[model samples]
Target: MTQAATSDTNVLDLSTCDSEPIRTPGSIQPHGFALSLAEDLTVLQASENLAQHIGSAAAGAVGLPLARVIGDTAAALVVTELAATRVLERPLYLGTVCISETCYFDVLAHRYDGVLMLEFESVERRASADFRNLYPLVGEFLLKLNNTVSTDAMSALAADEIRAVTGYGRVMVYHFDHDGHGHVIAESLADGYHSYLGQRFPASDIPRQARELYTLNRIRLIHDANYTPARLVPAINPVTGAPNDLSFAALRSVSPIHLQYMRNMKTLASMSVSLIVKGKLWGLISCHNETPSPVAFERRTACEQLGQILALSIESREDASELQFRLDLRRIMVSMLGGLTQGADFIDNMTSVFPALLTFARASGVAIVVDDRLLTYGDTPSDEQIRELVGWLSIRAHGDVFHTDQLAAGYPGGADITRNASGILALPISRIHKHYLIWFRPEVIHTIDWAGNPHAKEGAGPLDQLTPRTSFSSWRETITGTSIPWHKGELELALEFRTALLGIALERAEQMAELAEELGRANKELEAFSYSVSHDLRAPLRHIVGFSDLLLESASNEDLEKRHRFLKNIKESARLAGKLVDDLLSFSQMGRAALRPSTISMNDLVHGCIEKLAGDTHGRDLRWEVEDLPEVRADASFIQLAVYNLLSNAVKFTSQKESAIIRIRAERHPHENVFHIEDNGAGFNMDYVHKLFGVFQRLHRMEDFQGTGIGLANVRRIVERHGGKAWASSVAGQGATFSFSIPKELPV
Candidate 1:
């Protein structure tokens, strides 16, 4: 083969190279003949070697119907298949067609660029016999594959099987990584042959265009790397006036640069089958022969099937492993939730679960942020570095989870932090506050063994051909500032953990809200109680002093009835002052008391309160209507006190009525039970309802009610403390109803 020369001005520039034009090269390998036809099956162009296989010369076949050039049977078969579909990546084999009395050719038809392209190769009568014997071997190979456990084992078994089936000098399983670079993971070689296992190749060696073709065709064969490419007679299709697309052609001529690459490696023949896993190209099964060894279509089809089976097996094993990993992580999360429930602080709970997070994510370190506080565990960057990382992420991360293995490449300041933590998986627990839970992977300093020095050549190759590297020796290079990449399972686990962390944040917010509400109520109650105590004590003291002075002035000379009246007035005032003090102390005690809840009948509690209020109802005409109430979980003593206060107020306020009616009933709710006390009493105005529950907040004068105004206040305090609410509805001159609801269950 003559090498094409390149002028100095037109030397190949790697930076400006485009691989798209390679798809339609308008040429075929000389090993077979190709013919392109119009829509009416008229032969437009034929390969130069068409005369060798058929009775017609390439120039003479032009403008002739394809049926006359090949045969009526072959052309009819091609038309039948093409009529059903025009786009076919896989060719339709039309069997043997007799072009002449002594010559029979195997035909393949495919549609490309609106043109029907047919390829012909000479076939012997005994060709089917060789393929028939290969089926039993294929079945046995598949059975052996079923027993392989891991991906590596499967790769090794597949390589050995392909080598045995093809009789190739070497067979290698080349696996591509996330970055598109490939490494020889498994290999089967002849004795004394060089091994390519554990050797890496750069992504540019295959290029994006070649990878795309591999995905589409699935298998490619090069019978003779040194053979001259056979040109089409017209070079371009007559209908479209464009180069024919040979992307799916079995005998499509390869790029000259690739041929030079194979020649430099001393490879005479080569074949490759793409390994597609879950619709993506995973890798390739590459076979190289030292002599010109052409693989029959039947054998290559078998290789493609084997690759498909291997891909399915790899996907199954990977899915199973990931499932088990997720199950284990979920178990760990359950334990972490338990720990969080027992801990007093959110940050402390996260710190306690840090080890579990690291294990779940397979990370080296972890950082948790609750509000403005931050906590880190294991091998992590300095506090300052972590703060910077958090700040950087706060601005860029848009979702609940963000992860990257090459953090330094994305954020320049991360390079400083990469010494201890290169990869970061961040989960924002609170987006508003920028609170996050971050997992980190330590920088991994490792060496890569390349098949050849990737940096050996510069942009000095010929324009028509890319220079191939001369060496195949292993070249070692050190790499840094990158961690082991995060897998899909790790990202999923991070998102799951973020969900749990968010739950914790929500729970904390709820607790804070309840606490703030309780504190506000307590402050208001304290102020009311203070004012009530001061006024009640001072009024009684003034009464006692005034009556005692009157008694002292009357002495022995004054009338006995007047002295008796003064003494009696002083005694009554002192008693009233003492009772006021007792009531104040009781209300204060209710506020300070702890809750000890248990299952109790609301009916029994209400009945007990009625019995205690019987003394107050003795002089009054009372009618009681109490309904059956359900059982509840609450502090029994506190509930008793609350019921007593309500009953006492109902009885005292109704004393002025000729016939007072008290109705006590309970209504069931989804999460709580509500009890109501309806009383025909001296109902206060609705406008003063807000003040009805405050200590010393009285609508009626003391002379009319004849009691200190602490009963309703105590009732509100006790009910609220029990995780329930108290409210009242009333209108002046009408009956009033007081209702309170308690939860069905109490928290421990």
Candidate 2:
């Protein structure tokens, strides 16, 4: 079934309605004889000229067993092979059969619509086993094809080979474009013959149905363009009372319109072999002769095999080229990713990275719109024009990627931009913000030479038959407002690049959030520390000052024991103030430290931390349980510091317990690894968990825990810096489990 006719102006005006029905023509070329049989092998019909060879009246042959019409021996042979004839429209050669004592004919059989049709043609005298000589020639032809690296080279070589082998007056390799229109890419002609090379033919010249038949039947041969079509006896089959479908018949008659087309070209004989690639019609190996030149069956078979070999070579070469192209693009993309990491901000460094991106899509210019910042590189449109184009794309673009060669056709006021960037391949990184990465292609003006005037009309025939263009003169057309169209590979690369760019944008956003949080916390900590220093330090200083002043005044009068007590109180207050300052300095250093990430074993890091904190755990009845932990990519010093803080807190808070229990293990999540340290210690209230990881925020009294409330805060900062998070869960009296998660796979 065919689709409904489209009203697109560019569509070919092929006379679809008036075209002859070539498939079910109910006729055969006079060069061969045809006969039809019923399910029981009874002759139901025969060609009008059957009696000339078989000495039997065509009418009298009907209703007779095929054995009586031909011969018992020949009929038995045909029946034996009929059972294996499964493919419709594919004829099976049944060898030669003697029609009479003086004549022998080559027999071909095919089955259609439950009826068997057989064709017989006179066997021409030829050199015995002539096909055997074509094997080496075909081998050489294939070798030549294999050595050719490009499609055009292969096409040229094929045309030359076919012309040499078939001895035809002209042979051309006609290639079909994305549209059904064809052009002779390569041609070889005999002396005094005009060339059709580089000439474009409209799609209507071949019609849709004709192209379909080409795929079904790989080779079509018209021995003589002007030969009369032989009428089948009864015209329509007796059993079905309809025209015979001569689609697969070797001697099928040509359509009248097509014959007229051949006459218009002034060609006497023609042959076409389908050049199929990847199971679709790629083009045709068209052979035309200035005179009636019938190619022998053996030579035609060789030509068919050659076309098949060429198709395989074409597919292989194209695949290899595409693979190499993708590899090159991937290499360029990798370089672009490396460049993305050169600067701290992705958007700020867009101009520096723009050149690599433009090279990726082979575009003349590029425009990157990340949020409000728009950056242009190379020969780009004006700032106003770019903004306008981006605004248009914001509303009209579909999916994550949008591309067009004729940009002006889609966007109003885009023609000005098209002067430099006629084509645009745009990828939106953020839909909400309308962040985009666009590559631009400049206009490429060229001329197309049609075989005949496309707009001219010669005359109309009966039934409003669409007449073929009468003139063979070249008609040139200059095209504008377009750029070289983007290739499929380029589009695929753009999509891949889009994914990478989006990832970078997301990482940048995350880094910005982390910075903002760090800055905000620093400001709050500065304010809190200012107040704490004034209040907490003043109280300690007051005690030291009051004790020292009292001791100094009464040094001469006070007893030795009272003086010693005063001095001791002063020393204790000074030590407390000094310790607070040291803790504050350590907390500040944790925020300023640079991260050096490497693959380190958590088990080893935890053990090292425990060894360092041995003094705190000495002489205590502590039961330490450490499970096997996986290795992770992180800064060794930072992770160690976090572990040390958690472990020390567990030992300090559990000092009152007769026996303390601590456990360390790691749990795996889909995207991250979570490590936990649990202790059966003085757990804090769940209500105060929100303040647990804050700077200088303590859940327990300072006298009870002996901490500056900086341990958990440092752990949180370290985890956050490594693209992870930290939290704790506990009951009031049970144990607290402190856990931090790190991403399993780090991004590039």
Tell me, by TM-score, which candidate is best: 1
For residues 1-748, write the lDDT of model 1, one tens digit per residue: 1244454343223442344366776678777789988878788999988877675789888899988887786677666766776545567675556666676566677777777778876555523314575677667877887887888889999899888878899999988998888989999999866898998988878878888888888888898899888788888777778878888888888876677678777788999999988788899999998888877776777787788878888889888998998888888878887788776578877777778878888888988766668788988888778888888889988887888888998986987888768899988777578687888898999999998887775345343234556677788999998998887876786687678777876888898898888788878877876786678778888999999988888886659988889889999999988888888888889878889888998887888888877787887789999999999998899899889888888888888889999999999999999999999888889898999988878889987887778888888889888889999998777779999999876654
Per-residue error for 720 in candidate 1, Å, reads: 3.8
TM-score of each: 0.85, 0.84
The CA lDDT at 132 in model 1 is 72
Local accuracy of candidate 2 as per-residue lDDT tens digits, 317-402:
88999999999989998888888878987877666777787788889998887666888898889877888788888998889799
Alpha-carbon error at 507 in model 2, in Å?
2.1
For each candidate, what is the lDDT? 0.81, 0.81
lDDT of 1: 0.81
